[model samples]
Target chain A: MNQRDPLKRVLYIDLSRKSFWIDDRVDLFERWLGGIGVAVQLFKEEAPKNIEPLSPENPVIFSIGPLTSLYPLASKTVALFKSPLTGNLGESHAGGRSAIAIRLAGYGAIIIKGASQLPLYLVIKEGEVEFRDGSALWGISNANTVGRILREAAIGRGIRTIMRIGKAGEKLVSYAAVITETYRHFGRLGLGAVLGSKKVKGIIIYGKHSIPIQDKKKYREIYDRLYRLAVGSDAMKRYHDLGTAINILPLNYIGALPTRNLNSSRFEGAEEICGENIAEKKLARRVACAHCPIACIHIASIREPYPDEPYFYKTTFISYDHELLYSLGSMLGVKKIDDVLRLIDTVEAMGLDAISTGVCLAWATEAYKRGIITINETLVELDWGNIDNYIQVIKYIVEQPNDFYGMLARGTREASKHYGGQEFALNFGGNEMPGYHTGYGAIIGYSIGSRHSHLDCAGYRVDQTIKEPPSPEEFVELLIKEEEWRQILNSLTICLFARSIYNVENIIEALKPLGYNYTEEELKKTGEEIYFEKQKLKLKLGFKPEELKIPSRVFETPTPHGLLKREYIEEALQHYIKLIEYKTLQ
Target chain B: MYVSSHEVKRLAILDAERCVGCQLCMFACSRRFGDGGLAKSAILVRSVGGIERGLTVIVCRACLDPPCARVCPTDALKLRKHGGVFLDQTKCIGCRNCVEACDIGAVFWDYETNKPIICVHCGYCSQFCHYKVLGVEKTI
Candidate 1:
């Protein structure tokens, strides 16, 4: 890394004392690269052992990479903390102005520690920081409204990013998400609740600093090559056309959609809410994160008339992808696309993780139907495709008026323990299942993944491609290989959708003009090191890979690969544990 | 009167609705200086309100009698043959009068040099705009 690089600077803020300072962390960036790599090291250094995730002692770290702002598609920011949802390693990546904002602000990473005594928001500009009073903005029901208010109040119009939470976060719902740029989010594992716990309302960051390059001619050459590949090739066409929602029809066609709490794999009404339908009838426009040419973000327009005045209509734009369609649509058996969009809009407004919220509601619906929970526990009836009742229950989950709602707010893992529907809870390693019910690989991937996310290894991809399922050892090996490689991409903080375009060769070439000289082997080794560091931290935080419980509903439903046996998944889990432990020892 | 031989070319916003707010053009504008960043770019793109409303592309409209040149107190801003203005950095006193005069907010600031960065109408940025939202036209 260059000594003159602003990426070497680390900004530290302490809310308890209302102070901030900078340190030249060249050593940390030199060893770990950046993004998740730097974030994991910082988390280990700043966080105390056995600290509660909501406590001020839990550090919130945001980090970007050297390749950011210099190259196309390398525009994601990695946020690391101890999760309020899983009580373990919390890592989420978001693409928007977040990475560019932080980088141009002239820092490789920002670390926030301690809690404020009152509601507060921080405005960070180039070489300056302001701690503003957020007393009036506190308890705002809609997250979008918070963004709107702060947009008017803050500076840095286009180049800035505003990250804020909603009522779910304010109430400490374990699955609450931190909304960024109105569309993207740190959308998993309760980073929002952690922010809420610290009494921090929001953060706005922007800058006008310029980044230097080693060789001007080489930089232009590589930049042109990447830009041409991104724009000219078909590799990113699907994302640009329909976004991730394009996966819905195909996944449903293959019987891996996870409809209605995994009672069935395929949804009968999937055609109504799939990507093609939404793009045809509902898509309002497409947008992109800063520096990304793909423009994969799809926003849908939903117009409805006022109840009293038939002629008066209001149109609302809601962002949607495959995960939302599956979770809020097929997972809950809601067939109408408008109804699904409304559910997505509701979850977005309340600042909830759409996947976890839908999974929780799905479990409750099954529990209600089975006579395990009555209407007394749920103020409204829980039924499949009941949009109005589901919306009411979503509100109750945040308000938590009753004990049942309180338990539900904690997550399905806790809610099922008390409510007696553990088999249908559909959570892996305490985090709710994503849209995939592909086979053994998806289940095993969730259980052993560092963040319990499908993106960690994308094992579902393996299930989708393979004709014959591999043995448990082979399956674990394949996942480990992919997961290790992904650490490098994430360290650069590139959007995973551009993985095909940013192969190891291209990544090595791209770093040259930025002054990072590294061989392919050295980069691979760095990736492995970052992965192990996260695993070590997870172990320190009391993660037990062997103890991960698999909900029986996954086994009951037939996947595209046929029925998944519990013993086979358990075997894969053991193999994963052994491999990881063996690597840790070395 | 003798005119400069340089072609009177200026970047134009062809279709604001087609812009996805990628800001690739802005980056391309900065890259002409042999670096990668948004600091020196003379073009700006932002969402109208939220991204849902659509985007507005801000650039030099290449006016026949540019207001920026008229408001330049230092006489640093010179009018191009047909339209637009170019900055004479040596004479500029950094008054920022030209920045305030441009109602469209096309005159971006170079914070490092503490000078106003005006578009040269190279059309380099238009080449990178895949959506055809931007184009370059030669004016007489």
Candidate 2:
């Protein structure tokens, strides 16, 4: 074990006792190599089998890699928990001050368990942990306001991370996000709701511990090489230019946009609300994570006038990314860019996962139009592209004013279960599907993924670009291979944006200077092991890989590639099921 | 007390208007000392309140009188020829007098070694500030 790094400290906090303890888990660090690797292992150890996700027994783990502060683009923190949305293994990664702050704070991972009796906001500076009373902050109107309060109260202003939940999390909106640094988040799988259930409102991590290096010259050489690759690479520039929102126009152009309940693949108003127009018209600023040179976090400034005052206006900052655009802008049939920004802003303030929230509202609107859901149930006339009504409905979802909102707050899958819209529920596995409806890979990836997330496999990238459609067996193989490799990325917890630059050759080289000497084959084997561990967690929970569902809407609508035959999806999913099932025995 | 302001090179925050708050300059500062991480950083960047407003870069202002030097009981915070001060670790008693002395919060403390970390005016951090929020200048 390369115990050269003293930063491999695991901090455990028990909310029921309101006590914290630190342990040196260098063994886990050496095996898993940190980030998702360490987080999933901690989660499996602490989270009891067959325990409900929202219960006190569930564990929330945050882990960053040993290569985190030592390298550029190693700027993501892996968050693992049991999913309240999918009722299975939950994994989410976030970048900002989060990864660097946690790594510098002298910890490889943090495992928090047990529910608190009272509302609590954890304050962690360097090593000391203080459980601050968050009674005043609970049920705050906006998530931003909670961040503003913690930003001032916490020490180490320049180099710190503040992760807080908003009204949605407070109400336990099933897909509520644990927002970090205002813009970034552990955005999927209801990590925030798990925290809310524990009566924990927010967490602040501050640290500035010096890292010791064995070989200084080698460290500089690797750092310079990676940094140059990041800045010089055209792939990275795409993120800097338009961020992930760059995908909107291209995906729309390809007729795979998933517009308006995915009844149509192409969005007619894509030109008006696409990345180019937004970057040209409304881009307020671009920000980066601590070590990342690529400033992909794009903010838009939208000015709206007061109702009464002729000239009085309020300028609001709304963060935009590919997922938010697809979910709110196209999926909801929003035409105006400002309207999309407004919806994005509403979800951000409410602390909801914009993707799931948008999909839920889309289904609700379709269900209402089809007479499945009545006006009394919705409390409003839910319509397509109706921004004003959508705003009110989002508020209702967060507030959970009635039985309908409460059911919808659980997620699209749960909502569609009670109502008669399972066909158009548009959920892959139990989690609501992301923007892509491209091909077999995208469909199977979402349904079969451990996290039920697009980031897990990124099969959409393959589905959209490949010249020939991959066969059902080939498609399942693509997902399996990609998921395994992604385990490596998530473990290193490098930003997905820099995946191309940090190839296997570079990853093996990068690990050397950080005192983690490993061969390429060994790294591949590690990824394989990490993938099975996540699969084990999923199988241990209620998720059956064979029981994965193919939502009817995906087949009903034709993507740019063509109408996806039910046989193709079923065959591909079967192949994946067999693959995972065989792994359990070994 | 005679205020000594000598002619020498120093790093200064030029304009924070365009700062994106990457904190790469701080990484560069720590790297200059043959290590990684912000424990030994001489410069710092933070949001004014929320990140939407941009960032404020806090480095050695190269103070005219140098309050950090005046409060140093063991002369650890040596008054440099420039506006800032140089920290001599051997002389530092780790009492943290200089950390409290700087009203601008330029003095960063290293809890590991129990000493105040001051800027050496090497200008390494300024080179990495892509936004040019920081610059190296001659202060007489």
Candidate 3:
């Protein structure tokens, strides 16, 4: 009860015994600064390097940063675990009431360990933790339906976070994700499968306590300034109106939108499922995380008559984004918005990652055409923009009906290896490729990023400079530097979209009002340290950048700039390995 | 500067569709009285169910010749000429009279003070509404 607002209070949940306890570890919060910073330290301390990601020994750590719930845009929560798919350090970030609720619940982080005997849900309110029976809610198809049930069952409606797994999670799909608050997600590296392995159906957390501020006047001043800037800014307005789906047309036109298993960089029918189209034709609503001014999550309501019966109609509310549009729309040759929406809905209902699911399907389609997977053996024929087939295929992936579905559910790389099509696997570091097909930077970023993610290094953000390309050595160093600093922001749990507003200086100033004291240099150093710790974990887990396979199909396809030679990519990756090794030595 | 209930004034109105649930109005209301949090806030911004369902902007609608002030148990709730009812937090016991009397349900209760807090239509929230969701006008 005497704990400071931001200091670390660790909530430990033991699923095997159905017991939980809170332990205050002020040192953890004080030194690492919470979120990924604390999570990496904890991951190193608790989870062994040799443990299987889906095993009971693998610990799931969810942490929020010091600035979370204290600043306007610092509303993200970081979830860290060993990836079920990648077999390396796994981390995912999500926004919603998750961060705010975790902070307000008076805990810096929640550490979940040991698999349960039966389906269960953990409900945390204020300082009390309750283990609720979730047998009735197990194996639910729709992720949002769980939200409604949790909303009614839990105490907090407007203030709490409801994070749940769907059918894909229940079936232990390695690429499944944990969906929170209907739209937000612990999106990558199979966190949902981890939760499913432990039989945790959902976690609902809520708290209502006033936090202490360093200076009330100063806090109010900074809060007001950030609030005004966030609400009135043109950047935020764009996000509010069209959302991230706006990136579709521009990325497609610029030849960076990743079409047809990433063999082609342009999609001819990009406009049909673009952000503008979604906004004008199908956008039913927009939602935001707790305290976020920019509500970018777009939900579309589409009504159609039943296939068997004309009299009865089925109305489905599906969420859309540029990444999914690229992966499912253009990549799968899905020109019709309704087809793409249905495909996305199927993925969401099963709780599989839309990007990974689409890319996996894309790889399967290519593999099928090449006779690697035959129509007789498959549940559905893999084809472009075939919603009916896509729906059946997703269900099969979730169910892991046969050897092919089981391998495909693991990810494209494993599936490709099993089916003999490594040339078009479309995976980097065992994870499916994100929707960025920009040159060297994105490729190098995915190869070396601590989390093997697009947002980790944001190499695509500086795609323009990669036209001429940098020397292999220079590129790796620059990528490391950028990724390290980004670790700092993500640890702070700040939304990346607000990067312009909450620059290092602004972040420091903003944190001062909330009782944090650190110079920009110190913060950056902390971030670098955190990033290196994650690298150490990956190295211990037998990760070798030298061994990563760059799909051969990329070399044959000439991009907008020119043909991307395979040797250049190899050289860059070699440089990456050397840089990481050099950093480790230092 | 002492504007009483008899002084000539105006009222505030809000278009709910324009509200982004920024909670700026709640902050502005609490700030005017020199406090923070939902406890002191008069205007409330709560989502109808989820964020995708939009928001419900709850505040005093300022009924023509108010009934909340007239039905006050201990003469604590008073009619402000600017619009709506104002409560003298120190004057009344926590009786649930004015709460039921109002049709629009604008009378907000503060748990800490054990008193009803009503919007006075001073329109301080407009300063914080960067989206221009609120409008304040004078009645001739």
Measured against the true two-chain complex, the DockQ scores of the candidates, in the order shown, are 0.75, 0.70, 0.25
Which candidate achieves the best lDDT against the true structure? Answer: 1
Question: Which residue pairs in candidate 2 have backbone atoms (N, alpha carbon, C) closer than 3 angstroms, thus clashing?
Answer: B62-B83
Candidate 1 structure lDDT: 0.91
Full candidate order by DockQ, most accurate first: 1, 2, 3
True contacts kept of each: 0.68, 0.77, 0.08
Between prediction 1 and prediction 2, the one with superior DockQ is 1
The C-alpha RMSD in Å for every predicted model, in order, reads 1.9, 2.8, 3.4
- The local lDDT score (0 to 100) that residue A22 gets in candidate 2 is 93
List, residue by residue over B1-140, the lDDT tens digit for candidate 2: 11123447777778888777778788988997677888888778888888888878887788869988898888777766646777788888899888898888888877767887787777877766767888877775
For lDDT, candidate 1 versus 2, the one ahead is 1
Q: Backbone clashes in each candidate structure, one number apiece? A: 0, 1, 0
Once fitted onto the true fold, the runs of candidate 1 whose alpha carbons sit more than 4 angstroms away are B1-5
| Model 3 C-alpha lDDT per residue in residues A1-586, reported as the tens digit of each score | 1235634789888888777888878887778878888888888878765788889989999999877765667889999988998988889999877987888777889999999989999998656788899999997777778877887898755557899999899898998899987778888999999999999999998864445565678877777888878887888888888988988888888888888887688888888889998889998877666667677778898888978976899777787877889888888888989999988888888898988999999999988888988986476777877779888998999988788888889999888887788998888898888888777778778877877778888877767555577786787778888888888888788898887788888888887766678898998998889888878878887787778887876666655556677777788888778767888877
CA error at residue A234 for candidate 1, angstroms: 1.9
Candidate 2 chain A least-lDDT 10 residues:
A1-10
The local distance difference test score of model 3 is: 0.79
The model with the greater DockQ, 1 or 3, is 1
What is the C-alpha lDDT profile of model 2 across A30-103, one tens digit per residue? 89988888887888788656888899998899998877887888889998888888888888889989988888
* Candidate 3 CAPRI assessment class: acceptable
